[model samples]
Structures are given as structure tokens and as C-alpha cells.
Target: MNASAKRLVFLLLPVLATGCARTAVEPAMSRPDFVRGEPRVTVHRDHDDLLSAGLGLAGLAGTPVPFADPAHPTAPELRRRAIQASWKGIADLGPLGGYGQAYGAVPAVPGREYQAFAWVPGARQPHRVLLQVPDGFDQAKRCLVVTASSGSRGIYGAIALAGAWGLPRGCAVAYTDKGAGSGFFDYADDSGVALDGRRARRGEAELEFTPPPLSAGAGVAVKHLHSGDNPEADWGRHVLQAARFGLAMLDRAYPEQAPFTPQNTHIIATGLSNGGGAVLQAAGLDDAHLLAGVVALEPNVQLAGQGRPFYDYATEAAIWLPCALTDASFDATPFARAPMTRGWPQRCASLHAQGLLTAATPAAQAAQAYEHLRAAGWTDNAMQVAATTTAFDLWRAITAGYASAYLRRDAAHMPCGFRYAGMKADGQPGVADTATRAAWWSDSAGIPPGNGIGLLGGTDASTDPTLAGERCLRALWDGDGADSRALRAGIDATAARLPRTDLPLWVVHGADDGLLPTAFTSEPYVAWLRAEGRRPLYWKVPHAQHFDAFLPLPGFGERHLPLLPYGYAALDRLWAHLYEGAPWPTQSSTPKGQPRGARSLTPAMLGLGAN
Candidate 1:
């Protein structure tokens, strides 16, 4: 940045802080470069609010808003359900889970929302960006938060995480789907999700994603899995564009604050999961001093010298984690019910037949599998807790999509004969029902095995159907084939080298996070950054794991801590450091015991000062 950029931190408060007031003269602000065409602007007011889609905290905690018609739902209905679903997916929102009382409160904030398609210069399809500027936004604070979707979710993916934290603070929030969204394309009907959240024909309106032409009965296509963009490589740039979009949209909404530039605004980049990875990526690319600080929690990150890559570990889990989970000790984990774990022995059997497990009995094989995983950096907590993600078949579902994404393959060319679609009674790939299709925009997590879309492979359980595909995925990661080379290349592209910077930086991780293990992501990430001379505060919370929503089971909840409260606290800590120069704690919490039952969580349990 030039002297002009660095000198404006204290120069524009009087002229640019009055949000939403029109100016007599036209502003010199220009639209962000990646933004394509005109954006669809919606002004939320009176009854409808930005934070909860008018549902407030109480409404969000209750049942979802019913769609008048299941076959063809309205856009507003989709938006409301999307908000509720996004919230429930990220946090433990039940009364006992400490949603309303412990940390978060949903207040009504009328705001203007901007939704538009943003093109990555050489991408096949455009990613989506959304900007929400509350009517009561304090421009003098000049705070803006930009985040990416946590999983391969839609634009509202991080609403429950970053948006929940920032919007309540009167800060403008910018979100991007990061080229991975809940846009499903059904080849049979030639229909897809439109920009407005409606189901439309391929050429109707502006479709969010249109799969390459497929055979008549081909499966459903997801943007993240089938876009052929390998989008993770561009996650950082997507966040930067989202930040720019937020600033530009702020100028449009509050012309009195025209020309909202990075210099004058305190831009804070933050997120969770993949969204967390996105913010970290953006920080590395912020050579212009654009971002003032960053907070990433349990981010699925892979740095030059960090732990194992997501694809490598995910596929590894998909293959052997099942056999390991068959150990009787894991039966108490979340989703590890009898019906769910009944097939674990079968997976172990398959592993045994393939000579992967040398034990003769399933019990012995399971123990051997456990020992194998233990030697491969699988923590004791992660192995036990991962029973949840494994039972959900998330490992296979996640890896198949990532394999396709990392290889930049189209739907027709997905590896290991893996694909996604609704399943028939007989378990064959079939078209999704009208009711299922109607709710996809609001329900799908931008991944299959969700929103009624199932992964189509050889055969589920009884046959250890996903094993072959998972093995194929791992082969691509370890073999010497062309596909293997291509897959590794894409993973390399997503690698980060977050350089040392003076910006306020913080990273928090759940010590028991099984999905993106702490061993593979944050510990080494913080260590690498420190070695490079960056003094980022690192917090590793014990008793906490990824996926707070999955803590419904008594054993899971009792044994684990929710990750949200800590993340929110870190954000507060960052805010105070930015404004009050408060001391930032560099040490981990002293492993506190949590009051995890319903209505049991409190500020003291979280180690925050007091309520």
C-alpha cells in the first residue's frame, strides 16, 4: 500500500461514517472486478431482519418455517429455512446447549442484502457472494467481516458462525460460497437451483450451477463436487473478493460513506472449518495490508510444513476408520448405535480378506486396525469421537467429492464409479422426489448423503460397498498413475504459506476434533507461523471437538465441549485487542471440566471472565 492507503485510517471518519445517508454528488467508487453483471439487491426491513431472517433467536430455536408447497417453494421460504438449518448445523442450539443464554443472542437488525455471482477469471462457473449491511451499522467503527462457507455449503453457510458473531456487533458481514454451494443439478429433469433459490430449467433465469450434459438417468450434480474447478485452490482469493464486495456494497447502501476502501475500514477475516481455512488463505494473500486481523477455528488447512492434507487423511479414515470403529469401546460414541455400527464388523471382514488385517476374528482385527490408526497420528480422542463422522458415512461421502474436486473431474468422470443422487427402495440411483428437490436449496449441505441425495457407489454396508471406492480414492493419493499425479497437484495448489505479519492473529482448535484433526492442522500451523516470526495467539481447548450439533447424545455431550462459545470468545478477544489493546492470552485454557448437559453450560465453564 502507498502512503495514501496507510494514511486514511484516521482521515475519513467524519465524511464516511454516516451509513445509509445519500450524498449530493456521485461517488467515485467502482464495482469490484470479480463481480459480474448487476447484483440482486434486497432491502430487509420492519418484520424481516438480516441475522435470523425475521425468526429471532426464539424462532430459530423452534421448528423450521414450513414451506407452503413442497414441490415448488418460494424464495423467502427457502431463505428462512436456510437460516435455521445453517444455525442448527453449526451449533448446539437446544436450550441446554447454551445458545440464547451462554453466548449468543439474536436481535432484529433491518439491513440491505446484496447477492451476486462472482467470476474467478479462469473458472468454469461463477461462485456466489453475499453482503449484509445492517441499517444500524456503525461506520465510524469501520468494521467489516468477510468469511467463506464452512463446508461445501451455500452462501449462508457461515451465518451461524461468523455472521452470528459479527452481525450482532453492528459490523457488516460478507460471505462467499467459495465456488462450492448447495446448487444441485438434476440431469433427468434438466433442472437446477437458480440464483434466486428456485428450481429452474437449465436455461431458465441464472442457474447457480449447471452440470455438464449427462445421460438421461444420471445422478444429481453438486457444485463443489462436479464444478471441475478444484475450488479449494482459490478459497483465499474468493474471500478477498467477498471483502471487496462488502466494501463496494456498503458504498452503494450508504453513499454518505461512499468509497469505503480497505484503508479506512477495519477488515476482520474469520471463519470455521473450510471457512476458517479461507480466512487464513486470505491473510497470506493480503500483501496490501488489507486485512487487520484473522480468527480461524478448526480450519481444514494444509500448510507447507503442517500436518497431513485433508484428502490424504480423509481417504485414510474412509478406508480403515470403519474397521477401527468396530472396536466395542466406540459403541458409545455419537451415532454409534447398533444399526449404525453393525456394518463395522463387515468392513473389518473385508479388510481381513484383503490381508490388510492379519487377525482371524473380527474382534482381533478391530484391535489391529486401532493399533494401525494409532501409529498413524490418530489421537485417542479423535479415534473414539470419529465414530460419529464415520457412522454418518461422512468420510466416504466427503472423500468422493474431494477426490472429484481435487482431480477437477466432471460428474461423468467421477473416480471409482462414485456419484451422487437420490436412492430407490432397492438402493439404486434415482431422481430425487419433488419434495426433496424443493427443500435442497434450504437443506442440502452442499454435499451428498444430505438433503435426500445419497452417494451412488457399488453397494452400501451388507457389501462394504464404499470400501472399493475409498480404496480407489486413496490409490489416487498414493499411486503412481496420472490420476494420482493430477490429484496431488490440486492438493498442492491449496497449500498455504501464511507469511509472518504484524496483524492481530489468533487460531483456536478443538483438541478432540476428529474431522480435521488438531495434529494435522492447527498445532503445526501455529508452530510454523511462530517459527516464521508471527506471534499469533493459539488456544487449544480440551473436551471440545468439531461438530457441536452432533453432541446430542448424552455420552458425547458429557464428554465433549461445544466449539462455538470458545470461537466467539476469541472473536471478542480479537475485538478488544483491536480497540482496547487488551492483553491477548497466549496460553491454552487449563483443561476445564464442562457443564455440558442442557442448561448446564456457563461463562465459568468456558473460562470467560463472567456473565
Candidate 2:
């Protein structure tokens, strides 16, 4: 059958290839309906390839690759720099961090990368989907590993985790941003990120995002914050579309190996953090019976009405965690910067004024706040580790990004008086420079107070600068306003919607994960799954927590192990169970898996002897 005719056949009769066989008999080449336009395909060879964009393990470990011209970066330059930034953002590539020696590295896999924009059925915004098919892909024994970006990062966000493992194995790697990416729309410049990762004027190119117009100087618009899509609710659908796109592209890549469908190809979905949550959501929403298995690492998930929603706890932490961190016991928790933390005293005094704390001194108030945080479901270890995330202003940034998403609000009318602007040298909000605006697509992490985009407004005068906005955000959850109700409904919709499927599911979470506390997320969610008659494996690592990027900091490596190694091991076990019929590791039966104590990570840490 011809390519166009076969694509139509599959599009019209969706299930025509449900039982597609090894021997193709009129192959059902399904062309994904969500793919918006023709893919911009590029072949990478020699100095450039799938895993690292030509920068080898050593180069990726160093400084970020810079563009030849800041104002005009080509698709290849943006792609290269983004890949490097993503690697450093997600994994610990420090010399002693065990990337090349223990778990993963930039594997030299020559391949062709296909990039395209995919739209949800009725959504105006488009999320990016990229597929990498290595030259060594085994057509007969087909495999595809798919993932969504972990946090508010660009499309390359999870490449360090997924592509590093899959590409070397000759499996195609499918990635999607899941509606959260660094597609910044600078209202001041009247420009936005184009499909090729360049800054372009409104009508110059097909922009990745074009938020509601601002009144001349209201700053930039972040896709995650201003898309008005309630994207988290549709993360599962985005991932499913990513997989569908990968499958169709795979068919197109190798016409000789035609009829490659979900029924015939072994598809495994994996991701970390928000991406982790995305994969689990995909597992739940696999009503089409597409996914063969899922492996989620430190996933941000809540069982329907069972666990604390991210919005609830994240907003809570933004208000109280820093107040709690002033306690003496939190003196040194890896990466906490003392200068930035000095404002905690004023924050405590402000909370006291608001009747949130009733103590005589700031220290005493901090103790009270810590106790309050414990009451709100934070464990001692988790709160101690929360110092790292808190110091980086993670709680506030995450809440700001998600609040807009939940309310389906635009940048022009953000909730709680929040807005984004470029920061000048004097630390004031203004129009960012031409160079900074040009690099937004590759530099920003899809959140404000970063990459020249400063978060502004909410309170003109406050001792604690970000406190007022945080309080306003908390009030949204605590209040019964129409906007709050709408946001609440959106937050509630993020809970995994699942049907009964005993597909090979593996969940690996750090027991000491302070940001998404294991007690509030994985423990309860796993129990809920088992009660639903599905047996999913769960691994709770003792000395691990979120953010491997923190490992190179003073006490971090000594106290924690990287979750990437364990996550990689889980994928190994899942593949074995699927292809070799190997039994699921016995460690996961109990939520508390093998505990390698607070020491340096050894190769044996994953229970898989040396690499």
C-alpha cells in the first residue's frame, strides 16, 4: 500500500492494526492525528549525535555550550546548548558524581532527530514532541522509550535520564514537554519562541507560544504559567500523543519495517518528578492498551483523594518552610545559602502578625513553624532536606507557575497580583536586554526569577519580598472565591485516572524526598493501586532525595545517592520481565527497598553489580 493511502486506512480504522503481526500484510501505517506540521528532520553524525548533540561526556560536564551569535542562534546551536543545560539540570555530572563510572554518560549514537509540534484536540497551545531513532535500531525487536519533561523545562528536560539509557540500547527515545516548556513570549519585544528555538516577531514564524498581549511593558509570558490550559490535567494525554507520534514516525523512518504499532512494538514510559507523574498518568489513561509498562522516578503523584496535591503542599511550603528552616538544626543542609536565608526572621515576624505563629522570639517562632509543617505532613528528614529546595526559592517558583496553570489564567491577568518582568542590574524589573530576550527559549527554565525574567508585583513594601505573593497564593487555596474554586477543580483533576491494568509498573522514590515527601505521595498511592487489584512494584531509597544536581555540594554526596541509577536499574528489570520473563525484583514488595546508608554511592547501590 502507498504511504498516504496506508496512513488514511489506519486513521479511519483506528484499531485495524491492534494485532499487527511480524509479517506485514498491508501495514497499517498510522499517521498521528496530533502532529501539526511536517517534522524538521536533521541527521547527526561524528561530532553531533542523539545523546549529547556531539558534546561527549567530558564536554557535557563542563560549561554550557554557547551560541556563536546571541541574537541569532541556529536550530543546531540551541539544540546543543539545551542538551547540555538539561543534563546538568537533571543529573549530577560532577567528576566524582559517578555519571560515566557508575550509571550513565553521553553515548555516541549517530541518529536522525525529528522535531514537531503536537496539539491536543481543542487546545490552542502546542507542546513539543521529538523522536530520536538511532542507526542501530533493531526493527525486528522493536522498542520505544518515552518520557515527558520533569519540571518547567524545555523539551530536552529529561534527555539526561531517558535518552542516555535508551539511545545506547538502540531503542528510539520519544520526548514531550507535557505543556510546560521554556517557550517564553516577551511582550516588550513583541516576540516569541519559534519552532526552531529562535526568537522571532509575532508574524515572522510559527511561534511555540503567543500569550495574551500585554500593555506595552508587562514583561514576558511563560508557557507553563500563561498558557491558560490547565496543562497538568492533560499531561497523560500529551504523553500518549508523544508515544503515538513516535510510533508513526518510526513507521515512516523505516518503511521496510512497516506495520510497527503499539500492539507489536514494546513501549515503556519513564520520567522523573513531574515527568514521573506524567508517565504514571499515562499508565492510568492507557485505555487504548498502548503502553506495555511504566517506570516513574520520584514521581509527583496523588491517588484520587488519597494523597496531598502538589498545589496544596507546594503552596504550604512556600509560606512556612523558610520560616521553619531558621531552626538551629537546619544550620547546614547541603546547599542552603545563608545570605538569602537571612530574611527568614522577618518572614517569621510577618507570620506572627498574621496569627500564623504565636511565639515570643523569631527562633521560637521558627520552631513553631517547624511543628506546624510537621502537622501538615512533612517528616523530620523531609523537612531537613527541604532546606536545599527552599534555598533555591523552588516552592515560590513552582507555586507561581502552577497557580496560573490551575486557574487557566493568562499572564495579563495572573492570580494574586503576580507578573513576569526582566530584571536589570539594580535588581529592578524592566525590559530585558536584546541578547537576554534572544536566549529565552534556550536559557529560561519556564519559570520567572530566572534567565532575566524576574517575578514581580503582589506587594510594594514588605520586609520579606516574596512573602506577600505567597500569602496571596495560599489564600487562593484557603478561600472560596470563584477563581479558587476553579483552580481547586483543576488541581483535583490531576489525580491519576486509571482503569484495571496489571501492566508491569515500577515506582522508585527517594524516602527522604523533601520536595514531594514520600509519605504523602508514593506510600499512599501504591497502597491505593494494590487495593485497586493492580500489583505495582515500589522502591523507597533511603539515602536519596530529589535533585541530583545538589550532590556536588558539600554534604550532599556523602548523605545521598542519585535516584537516576536506581531508576535505570528499574528499567533494566522491567525490560527483563517483558522480554526475558525475569521476575520483578523482590525488594519492591515493601515500600522500603534496600537502604544503602549515608555513605558514598557504590556500584552495588542499585543491587546490580558494576556497570
Candidate 3:
């Protein structure tokens, strides 16, 4: 399979593979005829064609889906258009009808009831849901755990991951489409669809769940939600709504399958990366009273050291290049002018005197400059100043060129979040919240002035030095609404500040997560839980990056990443304790069944100060 095919598959399903073998296989029952059911979901059969292969692991074991034109619709595009057109005709059933209805079920390896539907009623485009109900489901006893996918991915990705943990244990899983921000997941291929302007070139999976999206189209563009990066939609609310909708749809579809009603069902939420954050937010939503617990895998949240002018100075410098790269319309005016650039010379001089800022080119120069600053005996402001000039070009090369496969992958996987914009509440073209503007960015470089780089020669009106003329200079450093109280209500809701019930919370984070580091999310979350006397279990994956927890490794044969499966184990323990009166295990072992190691969050982790 090529990279494009792989990316398409990524959009449709979870990126992680199952660690456990199938324990049960019920006989395939009569498949539900979705065409006759309520217009909730559109079920597609698994076939050898690229469309079916993109959604499910069917044929095309080693066969690659040949690419035609980069402009026209490929297999994934056709499917997306079909879904959108179908969504236009869906009758408004109000809140209950919005989630649509389940058509039929396909038995996957027996015992598992896999059903696909187009829930989420009022969306501009039709979002999809892939639900799996294990054989012999009892809502009164066993609980259902819905999942959220990362970035602009659909619920299929989460469904795939849930297959590893939940489905094996008679747990039902519902994965929702995140709007129009995902690609298709192809197991046979590697090269999948690329970003087509704002919309996905292939898959119209769930869009990014950002602060702007959750505002329910307050100041953001509704059309942009299905297209371009930075749709300015509040995705947190979308996730929560979709989750509630999914549960409702499931109840309507399989009322007799389980006795647990939406009100009485013990529904928990879990996700990885952005989805992880969404689940956390979902668990915190006011309507999430039924949500029992949350298992956040590398959730996107703030950290103490992540705040600017406090800690993690050197590490902040590393973010500049990626930030600039993702912002297609990035401007170099602010860094080229005074005040912001005034200290560059002195900082460069001090750094050079201390043996920093080596090469003159973009990549080399930026690396050399950051390396020296990272070493020792360097002021925080100095390194930040020196990184201004070359970081932009360096970031450009990274997005375009092929130095690290992960870098290219990260760039490709980025959602429609970052566009050069302002922070005003006005319904303008380039006005958005800090979180939406900084999370997912384009690699293009057509940054409109005053949006990305700030005003050319003006003083910042806000007291925060990072906010220059409405342009947030510290966007990448202080991403996801750092220091902003605008979305406090949403933030608090997602953070679950007011616990709905005493459901045992568990957070398993990868210490080496490149994107959403554990220091900012799980570390502080665990501390908050401890303070609240919730006694949350916080587990760490040592030397593992974010993607590493999902994808397979070359040498270790999947055994190297023992920390990944611990999340499932934790869930098992929770289920057993909640349902079967089993004692919850205080700690979980790595995938290899070994005792996991521990690490503490420190300033040095973000390159702020010495450990």
C-alpha cells in the first residue's frame, strides 16, 4: 500500500492495532437493511474496492489503490459527497432525530454487532458512526464506552481502537464522524489523501473539535467547518452532542439488545490526542451526567510550565518552526521589526559568545541556535529572539521536504485549526479564539498581515506581551486558549471541574509525546484529581511519542510498546470493579505485562529550567 492509501484509512478508522486475540465469535445474524430504517446512518459494505477497503479491512492485502488526479475526487471523495447529499435530505427529528438512526448490523468475526449510521442531524454535512455491540450485551450490568478520534479524524478510528479493548469484553462502542476533517483509513496502503485547501482531499471525517467550533457557530463560519483549516467551530460541544446523539441512536436501534436506557446506561468516554481532550470535555459537559468515567490518552490540556514568561523557554523555541509551518499565511513582519526583533542582535551576540547560532541557513541555523540555547548559560529571551529569523524557513522545509517521516506525517495529519487570524469576537473572516487559531495549521505561506505575525510597526494593545496588535505572537507556545478566559465555561465543562459522579478516572499518557505532552495534560489532571480526593490513576508510557503508542514499531514487534495496552487493562479493571465488585488495580503493567516505570513532571521536560 502507498502512503496516500494509508492516510485515507487513517481518516476512517483508529490507527492502533489490536493487542488481544478475538475471544468470541457469534454467528452472523440477518444484516439490517439500512435503506429502510430511519435516515440516521449509511452502511457501506466491505469490498475490495478502495471505498470499502478505506472503511474496513477487506481485500487489497498488498494491493495499492492507484491514484489518478490530485484535483478530482478519488474513492473517498465520492463517498463523502454521497454522505453530504444524504444529509441534506435527513428530516429534522429534533434532538432525538438529529442523531439519525441505525440501519443494520454486520457481524465482524461473529459475536460482534458492527453497525454504521449517519447521526448528528443538524450538521452541514452528514457525519458517520460505526458502532460495535458485543454479543450478549446487558445494559443493566455491562456499560457502553463511546470513543473520540484525534484531529480531523472520524469515529471509525476510535472504533478500531475500541475493538482492541472494549469489544472483547462485551462492551459496545460508538465512533462518530468529527464533521469534515478526516481522511479514510486503508490498512493495505500507506500513502493516503492529502489536504485539499480546507476540505480533506479524500475523507470527510469528523472535523477538529476546537474551542471555536464548540461555540455553536457563534463567531466562526459554518461553511468553513467542512472546508479549509481553522473552520472556527467549537468541536468540544460537537463531540459531546455527537456522543449523546450516538447513545440515543443506539437505544432507538437496539432497545431490546440492552435494558439500560440512555438515562440509566453507564456510558464512559475515551480517546487519544485531540479526541482524548474531547472525551474529557464530553465527560465534563452539563449533559454528560450519564458519563461514568474518562480514559484520556495523551489528552490536549494546559500545563503549569507551558505558560509563557514562566517555564519551558527553550522548548518553546522549538515550537516556532512547526507553528510557522502550519500557518499557511505566516508573516515575518513582526520578527523583522523593532521591540520583538530589537533584542535579536544582543541575544544573538550573547549566544554566539557562548557558542550558539552556528549556521546561516534555515534548518542548520535554527537547529544550531536552539541547540546552544538548550545547552546551558543562556537567557530565555535570547534564544527565543535568535530563533525568529530561521525558524520560518526551517518549518517550511520540514512540511515540504522529507527529513523525519514523523514530521511529514504530523504535518499531513494536522487538522483545519490554524489560519492567520485575530482574537476579536466580531464575525469576521480572520477572527477566532486562540485555541482554534493555533491547534491545526496549514504549511502554506500566504499569511495575511496582522493575523499571524501581527502589525508591522504597532504596539500591542493588550497587557500580554505576546498579544501584539491582536496577533498572538505566542500562539504556538500558548496554544488551545492559554491565558484566555473567553472559553472558561467550555474549558471547565470539558475539564469536568464539577464531577457528575464518583466514577474512577484513569489517565494514561506518553511521556515522550511530541504533540500533546503529558506534562501539560495528564500530570496536572492527576494532581487535580488527587487534590479533589478522586484518587485517579495516572500511568506513564516511558520514551514513547504520541503516534508511537498507536503505530507498530520495527524492531520490538509490538512488544516494545507495553504501555499502550495498559489503558485497556485499566478499563477492564474499572468495569470489573464497577460491575463485578472486583478491586480496582492501583497500577497497570506495560504491554509486555511488566511493571510500568514512573516519571514526574518537571520544568526541564519542557526545557524551561534545570531538573
Candidate 4:
């Protein structure tokens, strides 16, 4: 039989089936007729359009419908009018998954032009919309906006997990290509040519548990990468565009829907590493209606201030640039020393001549050097002086280049899985020694440098002679002082305007985090928040390196099963708070109790930190 005839025959065969069997086939094709026991909304979709329809249907069922727009009106009137319009729109778009029709892509940015896909399970086709929010309504809700760095390959494991968790809790997720057609995974692509005049260099191998490339219809991708080489501006624009897109999407989907409305919605911005930095910048700049909270994992805040010439000194001079120091006991005077007045080489000679090395023996100096290198690699020698230089004459001349290089590569590299032998967790003849005791110091002592302790001693406000000098010089040269000031002012202003203590925040960090030391980052932040009367939840997972806590089951190497129990439980608490408006949970006050790793951090602590 011909193809058409055979398809017809197959269709008839289902109808001809026994009574119970026939009923199943009928309901599968025809528009759902909600019977007494049927779902309020039944999702049905073809394979190609399933995800979009599924998400839209979920949004409809979970919240109130939206209203339509009205003519020109006052600010309050516009908001009320929009709310009504959104409700009506949703009501009219009722029970979305009946017809065989698929939802089309939506436009998220009007003038900019972008397409978006919304999915709800069981929908017959995808609901696609083109987003273009009205000029005044650029910051609406119901949008799923994403921002990433230029080289960011797209959403990966932990980030994807966050999206999955947020979807069920009332989020419509979307991402920007950041102008790089390839998502975050593009870095793995091989482009180098081979010497044989044939393709030999392959794309770098994929990282473990990396997410797959997204289909054209799955989400929207915007081309916003600029032509200039300004990474900061590029990043700032990426964030702003993401926020704008999110607002436009919200307007299109929910129109006038409340809670999801621009002013009422609780927008939570989060990202990892560079993406995390984008979220912070976006939130800091436009916290109104766009960002309610921020979760920046391994964010690079240091780069934000690198424009200052004072901070650029270290990068200018190659001193202490290659070592990885992490000792907590060493004094800070040596590391923070600047180049001598006479000259770099002359300074070294003078220090050698003075025999100042005898005062702080090589062993003691090694301990200090090792500590800084272990945590943050090497400090730029120039920046070190600007940050903490005490005696430019004596300390600057003492060139510790040999010790720095030895500890940086040979000694420090071995302990944390490198081949070289160094310190071990138990102070054994291995690299792991540093990892073990480092957590204790971070948890018990506020960051060493800031607290005026350990290797960073004398660098604090009291001892550092160049502290004021550096600050004044940096402020004088900062061209973007206005932008920096605006960001700080925005944060402060937002804190004052939205002084609601009801929102609970939680923070989670791995004790052995190498990239951003927990001791210097989150731990200190949490302490400040607490001192300010905000009971922030803080959890320090031992042995759990940064990003490890968020890994999926059969982790990167399948070495340890990812512990998502804490994350899961924290979500439950969050849902309760969001839906029932329950009282927020308190911060964990108990001392260290659990063993190192994800499980060591409890749900309570996670929830606390999330606040």
C-alpha cells in the first residue's frame, strides 16, 4: 500500500481496537475534554515542541492569568491596567494543550529582536512568542533571563540544576548567547590547524557532566558580544541586556499578572564564576523589579577594581606572579613588600646585604609564602605594595623570587593532586596537609589579612603605611569612579528602600575551595551580614571544593556521589516560605559537627545562606 493509505489504515486500526484500547487512542489525538476527574490543564505536545508547551502550561496552572494593555495612563493606573490585562489574557488562553496546534516562539526584546520558547508537558505543540515589551514596561516579570561571559559555553551541570529547581517553583528560564553563537561549551571546539596542512588539533575535550548544546527552539540566543576589547563593558552590557530581555518576556507572558508583575515579583539572579560576576553587576546596577536576590558562585569581584593603576602595579612588575601560596601562619610583610626606590635588582641586593633574612628564617618565610600561594596563586608584586607595603626600603629589597617560584610550582602544586611532594592535610609529607588545616583556620578566624593575623600581619589599616597612599592614588586615577560609586550607591539605596527582613538568605561554601578562599570570601561576608543583624545561613562543607557541592550523581569522576540532599531540603524550605509565607528559618549556631563534604552541610545551613 502507498504511504498515505498505510497511515490511514493504522489510524483506523486503533479505532477498531477493543473498547478499552480504542478509548486510549481517541483521547491521545483529540482535544482534551476535561471530565469530572480530568486535570484542570492537560499537557500534550509533539516530540519537537514538548518542552515549550510544558513550561507554558505549568505557568498558566500555577498562577493567575494575565490582563491586556490599555491606552496611555498614569504610573499606578498603568500597573493596575496591566494587571487586569494579564489576567484576561491568561483566562482566554485557557487549558493550553487541547488543539494539535503548537505554540510559536515569542519576542523578548522589541527593538533588539529575539525569539523565545516556552514548554509545558503534554501540550500538542510548543508555545513560541516574540518578545517586545512596551518602552515603559522594560522590567516586567514572567521572564527567564540569563547572562554569561564572552567565553561562557552555556549552562552546565550546577547551573542547569538550579534552572530545573527554579522551574517548578515558578520560573521561566532563558539564556543569552552573549553574541557567541556557541554557548559556554564552545571552548571545547577545536580550531587550531595542524602542521601537516591538514586538521590535526582537536577541540579541547569536554569537561565532565557538561550540559548538551541547546536546540534552536529550546530557548532564545542574543548576539550582544561587542566589537571592542573591553571585557568589563562587554560584561556590563551582557547583564543589562539579559535583564531587559527578562523584563520583556515577563510582560509578554504575564501581561498584568501579579506576583509575577514587575513590582511584586521576587526575581532571583544567580550564576557561576564569570556568569556569577555578571549577576552581581546586574543586581548591583538594577535591583529594582529585576533582581531580588543574588547567588554568585566563585564570582570574580577582584577584576572589578583592577582598572585602578595602584592595583595594576603588581601586573606591571612580574614579581610573585607565578607562585601559589596558602600558608596561614606566615607574616604578610614580605609578600606585601613593594619594589625598592633604587631599583628592583638593587633592592634585592640591599636586603641581602642587610641580613634581614636572619630575622625571619627561610622556614618561617616558606610557611607564609606557601599559605598565600596555596589559596590565590601569586600576588602581583606591584599590587602587593599598593595594598600592604610597610617599609619600602628594607622589605622591598629582599627578593624572594627563588622561594616564591619553589613554593609556587614545585612545592604548592604537588599537595593538591600535583605530582610534586609538599604539605599534606595532617602536615604529612604531601600536598593534602595544607587542605586539611586550612578549613579550621578559615572557620575560626576571620580572613587572616583583614583580621591582622598570620602571614598577612601588618597589612591591616593600622600597620600598612601605604594604605592611605594607595587609596588616594587609586581614587585619583579611576576613570570609571562614577560607575563604581553608582554601583555602591545603588546597593546601599536598594538596601534602604527594600528593608524587608522577611527574605531569608543562605550561603554555602566548600571549606577547601581553592579559587576563592571561603575564609576570605563567603565566611567574612556572612559574618558582616550577621553583625548587621541579618541572620544569614552559612555552611562550610569540608573537603568539598568549590562547585563540588553542586555536582550531580556519579560526580565529575564518579569519585563521590554528589550530595544534593542538602540542596533539595533547602528548596523545600524555600517553597514553603514563598507559597505559605512561613517564617524564615534561623541561622545555624552550632559548632562544626559533620565530616567534610556536601553532606556535612545541613539543609538548615543551606537555607540560612540562601537568605
Candidate 1 lands at a TM-score of 0.92
**Per-residue alpha-carbon lDDT of model 4 for 1-611, expressed as tens digits?**
24432222111110000111110111211111211121111112221111222223334223322222211122222212222222121111223221112211111111211233222233211111122222223233333434442122221112232433444334544343232211111112212111111112233421111222433221111111111122233343445455444554444444445224335555555554444445544544563435554444544333222221112232212222211121223225233322332133222332234452222443444343334343443333322222222222212111111112112222112111212112333533322222222121111111111111111111224322322232332232233665334333322221111113434555555454433445445555556556656665655554344333222211211221112233334445555564468766685442232322333323233232433
List, residue by residue over 1-611, the lDDT tens digit for candidate 3. 34542322222221001111122233333332321233223222232111122223221112223223323334333332322211111111111111112111112322322324332434333344445554445555656777765544433445434544665455666665444333321111111222221233123433222212222222222112212222112344545555555455455546565334555666767776656766665655546366766777767643223222211232344333222222222233223332333333343333334354455444454455445434533333232223332222222221111111111112222211222223355534434343223211221111122122211221334333222311322232335553233222222322334344466677877554434445456677667656666666776765444543122212211221333344555666677777778776555453322211232222222221210
- What C-alpha root-mean-square deviation, in Å, does candidate 1 show against the real structure? 8.5
lDDT over C-alpha atoms for residue 59 of model 3: 19
lDDT of each: 0.79, 0.79, 0.38, 0.29
List model 1 lDDT by residue over 355-402, tens digit each. 898999989998999999999899889987788778667787788888
Off by over 4 Å in 2: 1-30, 335-337, 585-601, 605-607
Question: In candidate 3, how many Å is residue 433 off?
Answer: 34
**Which residue ranges in model 4 land beyond 4 Å of their true spot?**
1-151, 155-159, 168-170, 176-241, 250-260, 302-368, 371-504, 527-535, 549-572, 589-611
Error of 4 at 265 (Å): 3.9
lDDT (Cα, tens digit) per residue for candidate 2, span 1-611: 24432222111111000111011133344567787667766677766777887778887777656766776666677778778777777888776677887667677888777778999888869899989899899776699999999887789888988898889988999999998888888888788888778788888988888776667676778787788888888899999999988988888788888667888899989999999999988888888888988999999986678888988898899899888888887877654445667777788898999898999898899999999988888998898888867776778777876888888887778887888888776778888887777776765556666667777776647678788899888888989989889988989889986644668888889888988899888888888888888788888877788877767666777777788888888888888887788876544542232333444455665555531
Q: Looking at candidate 4, what is the lDDT of residue 250?
A: 49
Error of 4 at 450 (Å): 37
Note each model's CA RMSD in angstroms: 8.5, 9.0, 15.2, 22.3
Worst 10 residues of 2 by lDDT: 12-21
